[model samples]
Target: MDWTVKAGKLSPEKLRSLIFNRLHRRRSDILLRPGLGEDSAVIDFGDEVCVVSTDPITGASCRLGWLAVHVACNDVAANGAEPVGIQAALLLPEGVQDEFIGQLIDDMDAACAQLGIEILGGHTEVTTQVETPLVVITALGRAPRDRYVTSAGAQPGDIIYVTKGVGLEGTAVLASDHRETLLSLGVEEAVLQRAAGFFDRISVVPEALAAAEAGASAMHDITEGGFCGALWEVSAASGWGCEVMVEAVPVLPETKAICAALQLDPLALISSGSLLITAPPQVSIVEAVARVGAKAYPVGRVAAAAEPVLILPSGERRRLTMSVEDELWRFLAGK
Candidate 1:
């Protein structure tokens, strides 16, 4: 069996037992706690609560340090909390250079500074157990006890919004890692540069803050599973169905071109910089995102139906699904 789940590949029950259920370790000393399925892990902290999350960069190592911080911080921000600190673990292959390590740390430090977050202590080592560099970041954030948004908060009539464009992170990674192939395929150097430049757009701080301020009921960062994955997560968590118009989801022209070149589905690619927000249909989510210099669009709405679905521009309705085999898999496999 594959280690990850993908669209049309795994039943919901199987995913619950294998992935979601194992994410938690039961403890008896916690109060005001929600289950493991929310965007962030909530823990009681007196008058306020802390939203914490940790994630590792496993697909690529070129910009491991920078991506580590932003990916983890994005999750914390999705809960409508400002990221305060991050703890990072750096694992490198035995032959890695000291200069490389220094450069990595420098980049991470600069990224943390830009986000106004502190670097709490973490472990670092070069070991034979790894063949490449790996970074894991744990982020800490606080929210007013009453204001935190969870995946479960979306209602039937809530509007579903996405920030920025789809496949931002995936495009960047592909451009960087497969430069030769892309250039040979007539991909313009400028287009490649723009795709690689997506690194700067990885943070979701602005969207999270704006949506929270605009009375968003729930927000989620679209990461490994891309837009399709995010929709599944949000709808599944909220116990509501969603109908997304295939044509309404935004994708950069370069992203679409790259997907066509690679014969991959942009909707199924990873998109860490994109944010999925759910709010009352009457709210001006587009204006809210614009206030932060981010683009937002309504791709769908929560439906009263019990199953998630997607409405294609061709007038076909199909079940919305996510897969663990992201675009990373195909890109890395040279498929």
Candidate 2:
């Protein structure tokens, strides 16, 4: 019959052939287009370039509008652009109360206001086809054409840095959407509350722009595939290898508690607030990130094109294959 697929993102192979390859037409002004590791599209507009990215909110039940805005804008920021505005499409399941839409818009407004961006425009509707509310946002930003970064620009000897703790968004989703389940599993309400607060840290705009200005070689947002997936994408896109110290990857206490209670791999959990960056060893991205009130953790370095390996906490090496998948969907799917 026809092709069938899983619920999460399309695998890199299928995406390249079916999506990326299908776009045969090209424009000279479009410097950056879609690719395996690319999350945004860049269009040259004379002196400056516009970086636009589209993302949909699906995994989490709560904060749909907020997540939609931040997630889309996060992609633009990963390209080292200054986000200016967004256009959101809200698709809601039928039979929902009016209060629900109000809250969703309010959340979106709050997020946009915090980021100093506006909701330019979009469409919203209630439909029977959806079981839950879905928010899709298209965010746009601008930066000097010569200063923008890409996921495919990493080279050998570049230091790999991940900003903030991994599994941040996953921890928040579990805490907000599955609080009762976690409470029953002995997680304290305080921990859950803190986890929910992680929503505020969802945007990587400040640190990403800082890294770009610091001459970062490559940058990627840790989203669906978590840190593991982001690492694989950067390595694959850059056509290089990486050696990461597993112990050096930071995890919040609340994230650890939640993942442990749920038997989830924090490294493989969906982590949206984290940013993976690569830069020359001499560049001081640490200071640049710190200036933005964020910290950069050096967890690895880019190596020759061989294979990505993780030096486990126990000193044993494990290969990080392209097959790595996000853990959030597995739990949500009850698999």
Candidate 3:
């Protein structure tokens, strides 16, 4: 049979059969290669493990450089590693101005500086193949052999917690990149401006580290598929299921209003700033996240149901399966 894939991330089932299972490379030093929910690949170096992850900024038009750095770094952080360095790849369209590249580099440099990460090295070129500028970053970090965490470590009895509200990156991108379109949709200027500030909330290093310190079993950054997607990934990786309370998940007022105006589901939108954590029943992961100037809440519990399920406020249960496309992509395509 002839087959093709669509835009956005592939479904988890395809990832397992078509990609991960086919990797022939096997080395004892490779502590973790790749799996359904695992983000960074861990390479053992005796006492420490090097964690590496790569992500690209293809969806957001505003602050592409900054988003590229944080999104990739978040994966390393989620693995309980200290993000230390990054390498960027930039492809610019033909006839692009030098000043634009300079500004983009400046933005990347500034963002890396904020996180105490070094710009290792990368390649940049202006080419006719791209219609717009695209930035990809590979983030590197390190952790003690015993301290590193992965999404597959969660146990059945652990509690699932989420830090920060959902739809952060998507809300920011829609408000800033598609500002005029939102205005045409009758979204207030004040709402758009406030939502645009969500860019600053896209980093999850602090909360991830805090959760690790408090004895987290697993951690996943809520990214392209929002909170629900993250919950499903963590559950799938751990060979367990989750029961999430819909009302317990935090959804910001701006996110709700913006999503409503655009006819999108906030829970299905891309949310980069949020973090999903699973911890022992007695561990206070929420308190740990709060100490880092962010807040977390217990939204679900790990179970043996064999599939992740969402519990609505009305007591309805909805099983969640990985989707090929994110709501953010739909909105962007429509725009």
lDDT of each: 0.83, 0.91, 0.89
- Candidate 2 wrongly placed segments (more than 4 Å): 1-3
On lDDT, the leading prediction is 2
lDDT of 1 at 334: 65
True-structure RMSD for candidate 3: 1.3
Order of candidates by TM-score, top first? 2, 3, 1
For model 3 the local lDDT of residue 291 reads 92
TM-score, one value per model? 0.92, 0.97, 0.97
lDDT, candidate 3, 1-335, per-residue tens:
54676678887778888899899989999998888888889999889999999998888878878888999999999999999999999999998989889889888988899899999999998899999998989999999899999999989889988888989999999999888888988999999999999998999999998888889999999998888788888887889998999999999988998899899988888999999999998998978898999999888889977989999989999999866257898877675
Q: What is the C-alpha RMSD of each candidate to the true structure, in Å?
A: 2.8, 1.2, 1.3
lDDT of 2 by residue, 118-210 (tens): 999999888988998888899999999899999999999999999999999999999999999999999999999999999889999899999
lDDT of 1 at 299: 88
Q: List the residue pairs that clash in candidate 1.
A: 5-324, 6-323, 7-322
Using lDDT as the yardstick, the better of models 2 and 3 is 2
